[model samples]
Target: MPDVEGHPTREEMDLRTVLNALADPLRYGVVSALLREAEGTARTCASFNLPVSKSTLTHHFRVLREAGLVRQVDRGNNRAATLRTEDLDACFPGLLDLLRANP
Candidate 1:
């Protein structure tokens, strides 16, 4: 996530959370997009976001949060999401990097 040299230590998140979150294709796509740059990336829940319904997008976010692949926080009137790269790395070394960097 944050590549800052002195970034504050983070709390270790649950592994099952991360795995279960990414189990779905939609959530996987969201995670992929978020990790493509930075966390806390915000996007609309239109079909253009992905080949899914707005309600499905909400479900995907909920699954991702419960599973731990990404962290969702309320920002203003919107909810922002970010991939838990550090927690994922800790749970499965190099797995996130490999997945993120995949061709």
Candidate 2:
């Protein structure tokens, strides 16, 4: 499938991208929110419970998308973000499991 931005599909997303995307506390929070929601359920940009500027929020989402930690969909006025559940599982089978098991 085409990426959110209509870019060509990447053959594979990298581990570093996943890790770097999740490294930030805010981005982590965004990931957590997605995890709380159902699989493939797209969440609005305003759904994030963070105290950041609009530009900053956009930046965080971009990081998540580039890292392949999340998939974003353009919905006219706003964008929706969801976890890359299957891709992540295939790339790092127990990554999230370990995170949940530890944290």
Candidate 3:
């Protein structure tokens, strides 16, 4: 699949970067929510309802996107985010399963 602008390509995704991005509880929650969604589902940022302010939430998403854990695209006035499941699976097998299990 084509990557969202500014997102790392599947081959460029790195384990350390992903781990760092997921280290934050709020960021992990965002990813976990995406994991529970139907495969390929893209959710708008506002839908997450995270406790942080909009700017803070944007920072979280940027971190995830830069780490290659999510693909984010502009949807009109909002941004939509989808987990990079295929890329993550290819780069680090069982990682998502571990997250699901722990959560």
lDDT of each: 0.62, 0.77, 0.91
Pick the winner on lDDT between candidates 1 and 2. 2
The deviation in Å at residue 103 for candidate 1 is 5.6
| TM-score (all chains, Cα) for each model | 0.67, 0.84, 0.93
Question: Candidate 1 vs candidate 2: which has greater TM-score?
Answer: 2
Candidate 3: residue 92 Cα off by (Å): 0.4
Name the top TM-score candidate.
Answer: 3
* lDDT tens per residue, model 1, 34-70: 7776555555434226776767777877776666566
List candidate 2 segments past 4 Å from native.
1-10
Off by over 4 Å in 3: 1-4
- State the TM-score for model 2: 0.84
Q: Which residue pairs in model 2 clash with each other? A: none
Best by lDDT: 3
lDDT by residue for model 3 (1-103), tens: 3254779988788899999999999999999999999989999999989999999999999999999998998899999999989989999999999998887
Candidate 2: residue 35 lDDT (0-100): 74
What is the Cα-based lDDT of residue 66 in candidate 2? Answer: 78
Worst 10 residues of 2 by lDDT: 2-11
User: Candidate 2, residues 69-92: lDDT per residue as tens digits?
Assistant: 777888999998878788788778
Ranking by lDDT: 3, 2, 1
